[model samples]
Target: MEKVFNTRSMIFTLYGDYISHYGNVIWIGSLIRLLKEFGHNEQSVRAAISRMNKQGWVQSEKKGNKSYYSLTDRGRARMDEASKRIYKLESKAWDGIWRMLIYTIPEEKRHLRDELRQELIWSGFGLLSTSCWITPNPMEQQIHDLINKYDVASYVTFFQAKYEGMSDHHSLVNKCWDLDEINARYTQFIEEYSQEYKLDKQKIANGDMSDGSCFVKRSLLVHQYRKFLFIDPSLPKELLPGKWIGDAAADLFTDYYHILEKPATRFFESVFEN
Candidate 1:
């Protein structure tokens, strides 16, 4: 299997485990155990711990060779936000129906099978058995929409609730993303960037527009765009307005992208490649 590391997902996974099993005091051994369960090797787990600690989400104290760790208040706040996002995405009332599904695509359609399975997993579905999927939440409509969107209606069959208490790994995984930290970092970035560009309302409103150039606007737009991208792209259109505060936020995002997109891309590329 190809390994993927999404910062949001990884952070959620770590903190979610802390909240669930350790009540925040996650010892080194416990963290190692959990990481092993998630298919991480010893080195990777150590690196993750170091990186998170450096980023201020976790604090660790070393007693001899043993390290004990716990979330900082900032980390705790991030965990709380991640939990809320998970609940919003998955805690819909159970309709007393499982909405199980199975696909019977031809052998040549094996690629489709993988795609469908991934889609189901992303939508918070659980694998019950070979070719069978279920969810604790009543998301029959979502399943139906996916089936139609993927053109798999012919190769798939749906059934009503046959099983209960299906475990949702997505919610569990999402809890680790450290949303509070992510939000905090972004908030700090916006504030500093705004000040650096002299776009602070008091500054800009008081004839300081000399420094309020396109750079400030571009920075703000990029941050906002990244924020919206964290949510599901397929969410109902009505949920996000096209404009905010008498500005076409989407259009501004586009303009910002044109200005900073290449340079920003290069900056991240250099960091990651190094």
Candidate 2:
């Protein structure tokens, strides 16, 4: 809601933050009205919808004179995978062992190998070397499913072992994660939303804040935290250093989200009310 001007991104956000709950379908007119509130032009919205259709992310149907759109199977699957990472409220208890994936795809299949790298990263593996990836959490199922998806299971080996490093735990973590930058984002999110949360919260109580404003602010809140799925390995707390900002950030996010959810849902439901 408060970021770049990519029409595709706005459409995806609309689905992830709202449309997904609204039966994953929307009338074209309703989508246009919503996008216009976010400063998207009608043409841009249509073009973005077309591009998404080409990519098998969304499909459109016409009923009488009005159009409707919904996620395709591919699109729904993508959203489900992302939601697993983004909306997981807590990590399972750690077993004090790290899961490591070591792979060697053949040179001829280099493109698949490159694609595998992105999958590993998004699945929370930190690259320790060109051919080695590691995660503090158990990733047996994740690694198996991934390599199987790429049909490269034969090229990959898995291990579960405790870390025995030359340096301190902090150094070991720093070697694999950019915790500073990640924590900075948490701080930035807090700065951006902390003040508005209180004032807007009262406005909602007093029947002053409009439904439109609630919708925008709630989506922005989700977008701010959603970036972590790309960067956060979601390592266990035992693996994290003292005074971790991620903990604080999680607390702040939960509080602010609860404060906003009711009013936001009220607005969202109003959009579809007959």
Candidate 3:
């Protein structure tokens, strides 16, 4: 099957990976040039960025007849969070306590409920029941951010408590998330990227890879790995399965990213600086 990328999502990846490091701003023309490496055209890039501006993820400035875009505070916060997760060395030790959230928002506020669910999932909260979400990680700040962002302080309740149920804690985990499925995804990422990493590393060493090619490969690599955020709750070692492949995937991603990093940045700056 042919791969397809959402233009807006690719913009988010680019901003998080590249533009954010370079003053968090890029001329619209320069942004279009960088995205062109991924087969995104000018019109699509323009439209996607316009939508982001409207959604408060970015804001635009006019430089004479030229336009530039920069991350808004919300955008910077999200990018900071994503970068931390993406490059994390390890999950912290579990404290033997699960953080839980339950909500009772009225049906009339279904939109807020839906959006809140998505944010919770993105922050590693797995659905335990129709109205309950659970995680084993420390998430006090994330919980506070979600409540404030959604203005659902009255509708939501958060807790930090040990699981004293008849079933073991692992059973509670199984009820909330599919560890087997997440492991399978990690396996796939390892299989595909391992081979690509070997090939690209050899190419770079042989001086056969161009900066532009490296830039494209690196961006795609980060984009693919970033999908794990939605599926993998980044459970601590104690909560994970006996033989998880996520660590292997993380290692491969980090090593492969290092191989592509310098050249990719060169290419990005070549476009972004002009």
Candidate 4:
């Protein structure tokens, strides 16, 4: 089956997984060449990068009539955070406290409210109710940043407290998020990538896979795993079910990533530095 993609998102994946490692910059022509492997044409690449530049994720430079793009400070920060999360092999230990955020944005500022909700979810916050979000992770700094970003201090309240309810923490987790659904997605990823990984490993051993092909496979691997960032909360080990598949998936992703990493970087540098 063919994969349906968003050009802009694919650009983000390239920047995060490949470009950042190579001086965090790329010439427009090289980027266009790299993206062509995925069926994205020059026009699509130009349009996507233009939109990203306008969105403050990248800045353009003119170097002797050639255009180059590099991540802005905001974009680098996001990529750094995403890289850390993407490669995390295990969940952090929990302190047995939940951080809860409740917001009451006025009707006039509904747009900010909507954006904040997405940010919350991306930060691993689970919805407990209409306007209340909860997470077992430490998010004081993230909460402060969110409030400052949206300028909604007056409409939001934050709390860190232990749950002393009649039901267990597991029940609370169930109330906020669907663990089973998330597990199913992880299972699918494992099934899909595990086979590819074994096949690629053999191909690389036999000198059958080209460096350019390795680059494409590695990009797709990271892109696929990155989707879990939106759906998996990366909850503490204590909060997860007994038979969680996320850890197994993480292992597979890490192994596969390493198998593709050297040749992939070689391919990327050949295009980027030429």
Candidate 5:
């Protein structure tokens, strides 16, 4: 939910351009140009490049003050992981309707207005225009209930109809499900980190917490472990048997909140970015 120029996003932005152009070499100038297209300035782009190089995600060769970079195996892995997250964030199922609503609350109830708006966002509703929100679900009654509960019924109007069939909902679903490769990559990441950080599963299971040395390593491992339950938050608890799952799910949710719902919800938000 907090905006940051994460390594994942930077990998995707660069790899996306490479794939688009059918080329393997990405020059410094080209990286700058692509970042500019994504609304980033030169300094930010340079910082991302430096970070990537430092992390061994990419390798650069210099020729007369010009640099050309290519993805290392590690970079490819990161890009692969990012692609899967993007797919999960994008795919959805559609039951036809695109629900809409227009509400006008009393001026004095601005706090209520803000709360309702946040609720809608959490519920996968996107604003199509001021005072109007859209969702792929046909459950207008749920929206009505929210409005009434918030006491905005006095100034609200609701509408619902089938979205014109212009979107590829099935393609979106396929993308999300194409995460097996990403899952494999993450498993590899966990195994490597576990060895590097000397994470002892037996000790952790036996209640020994002293092995927690690398917080960054621990955090990255936990994040990847959580992707298994991204689409279904209520997955059987037996899938993850450790205190880390219990203690860290809440925090990791912040990083992965977008994919913590049904595929339909993901599809609607991706197709209709508010």
Candidate 6:
């Protein structure tokens, strides 16, 4: 299955994983080369950069002839919030309390409703019904901000309550999440990297891991793993099934990621003068 890839998303990944740590700045030429592996042409990458700049995600600066791109304050804040979800592994024990957020944005405000739905999902909520969303963790602040932003506080309700359904927790999990699909994706991730991890280890030990190769592989790994965010609710462990494959995938990713970091840094440094 060819998972969807967007030039825009890839650029974000590049900045978040690499440039964010270095100085939040990237050379245009280096960026084009980085995006080339994903089949994005320089024109398209340039367009993506321009779009990001217009959207307040990035700003461009010229130094002599070469140009550089860096995240704007707005973009950094956005990435910071997103990174919380991407790297967060829920740790607090589930209190068995489900926080429910219900909204009624009316027909004319359907756009607001749609936007709110996406925000809720991003905040780890699962839909119980069209009007109601639930999460095991309390997201009062997120919900409050969303409501205030949309000016729909009067049309929304937030409640902390226990489940009163007849179904078991397993049934609820199945209903809230597509565990089978998530497991399949995790299994795929595991299969792709577990064997590669061994070879990568050997390469590192033998000093055969090239800087460019490390950069490419690490980028692919990070980009691929990020797809999980679109599907994963990041549910707490207590709410997950026994032997969740995501746990294994996370472990493998962390292991391989650290191994590639040094070489990838070397590659990036060589490409970006500053």
Best by lDDT: 3
* Per-residue error (Å), model 3, residue 53: 0.9
Listed per candidate, the RMSD to the true structure in angstroms reads 17.8, 2.8, 1.5, 1.5, 19.1, 3.0
Clashes of 2: 0
> Clashes in model 6: which pairs?
none
Q: What is the TM-score (0 to 1) of candidate 1? A: 0.33
**Candidate 1 residues 43-85, lDDT tens each?**
7777877888887778898777878777887577555644454
Runs in model 4 lying further than 4 Å from the true structure: 1-4
Compute each candidate's TM-score over C-alphas: 0.33, 0.85, 0.97, 0.96, 0.33, 0.86
Report backbone clashes per prediction.
9, 0, 0, 0, 0, 0
Q: Rate the local accuracy (lDDT) of all candidates.
A: 0.51, 0.79, 0.91, 0.91, 0.50, 0.83
Per-residue lDDT tens digits of candidate 2, residues 94-121? Answer: 7878788899999999999998998888
Cα-based lDDT at residue 22, candidate 4: 79
Query: What ranking emerges by lDDT with the best candidate at the front?
Result: 3, 4, 6, 2, 1, 5
- The TM-score of candidate 2 is 0.85
Give the alpha carbon lDDT tens digit for every residue of 82-147 in model 5.
444333422334456556778888778899989888767544465666877765544466576677
Task: Give the alpha carbon lDDT tens digit for every residue of 144-179 in model 3.
Answer: 988998899999989999888999988988999999
Which portions of model 5 show Cα errors greater than 4 Å? 1-93, 138-141, 165-274
Clash pairs (backbone) in predicted model 3: none
* Model 3 C-alpha lDDT versus the unseen true structure: 0.91
**Candidate 4 per-residue C-alpha lDDT over 1-274 given as tens digits, one digit per residue, 9 for 90 to 100:** 1334778998999999988987898999999988888888889999999999998999999989999999999799789878988998667789999999999999999999999999899989999998999999998987897798779999999999899998999999999989999999999998888888999999999999999999989998889999998988889999999999999999999999998899998888888853
Q: Could you tell me which residue pairs clash in candidate 5?
A: none
Error at 71, model 2, angstroms = 2.9
